[model samples]
Target: MPVLIAIVAVGIVVVVLVVHLTGGSHTAKIANEDAAVERFLIDYPDVEVRQCFLSWDRRDAVLELEDGQVGLVHAVGVNFLTRLVKRGEMTARAGVSDESAVDLETGDVAWPRARMHFADSAMARTVVALFDKKVDTTDNKRAA
Candidate 1:
């Protein structure tokens, strides 16, 4: 009986350790992007949000502010993953087609530059405030 009890205790300890190491289940870590948008709307009632779009593959969100500035709220380090891929992880199934791999790779390495134009500094500030609420800012200090 003591051996059986000991076995059960060890099993429980192992399960707890695995859960802690893995940092919880994927579902708990995953947030519904739509819910995030709703939260933004609720939080910033002053800003008239035009649109909110979420990335298909990841949790990046793009929100259009009332003053016409498009705010990009993304996981800060998500781009690092793309950078790593561009550094030559292009396998046969890395979405590289024979017809356009070279061109695609060149574009990947020299990613297009994006310019952010705000109507005024205040508008920029409001957009940024909304963005911070939406994005997970812990990964990058630039979010601060």
Candidate 2:
């Protein structure tokens, strides 16, 4: 029965795929503040990093750079994306999120928005404050 054999083969393939995906989930994370800073500097050299605010799960990060530039790094599946965004490129809100969460709505399509949860409520609000700074709209280029 060819149909019976095909069904068995399909089932085997599905089982293998499921196992592979779930078993390989030591999924990438930023690990710590230094690692987050390292990842961003690797992409955009020549910029000075003043401070870092990372998520509790180590999957998101916010960097304070020289001249008031901001860097965003967040995990997407097993990979991470880093961006040097301008002030108006996104919005951050603390009240709407959980007590320890900071919500960011970045206008970029690749990584439009992210909700980063911190262990401290104060840190969450501080992250939101980073987006509140005022600056010239034309001073910097779009995030890389």
Candidate 3:
């Protein structure tokens, strides 16, 4: 009984040490625009990154690709989740708690949505605009 108890105690200590050493509490961040671009490119090496913008909390990175395709890099558990989003695929809006934050919904089954917090409302709106789809009024017009 004494030896079993000792072994259990040492095992618990080892587990705790491993977690602490391996950054168990670490929260992933986008770091910067360049970092965000690089991270996105890793999963999509064929595409070129024109520009990138980081959210206020550094939890999200919104990128503009060379072909006008939009991409997103979201921090998840010390890693990044990257996706290429087509125009009009997402709906962006501000969160209830923060005006400087944008909530995005892509209607994707696996990766449905994300939230980005910006430094200001303007930045938030800019992110929202990226996802906005404009109506082509000319297509709906009838020749009288």
TM-score for all predictions? 0.32, 0.79, 0.76
lDDT of each: 0.41, 0.84, 0.83
Which has the higher lDDT value, candidate number 1 or candidate number 3? 3
Off by over 4 Å in 2: 1-26, 95-97, 135-144
lDDT: which candidate is best?
A: 2
Locate the minimum summed-lDDT window of 10 residues in model 1: 80-89
Ranking by TM-score: 2, 3, 1
Question: How do the candidates rank by lDDT, highest first?
Answer: 2, 3, 1
Instruction: Itemize residue pairs with steric clashes in candidate 1.
Output: none
Model 3, span 1-144: residue lDDT tens: 999999999999999999989898688998789889888889999999877779988989888776667899998888889999877878888778888888898798877877788889888877777666763345348643
Which ranges in model 3 have alpha carbons more than 4 Å from their true place?
1-17, 135-144
- Candidate 1: misplaced stretches above 4 Å? 1-23, 27-34, 72-144
Top TM-score model: 2
What's the CA RMSD for each of the models?
15.6, 6.3, 5.2
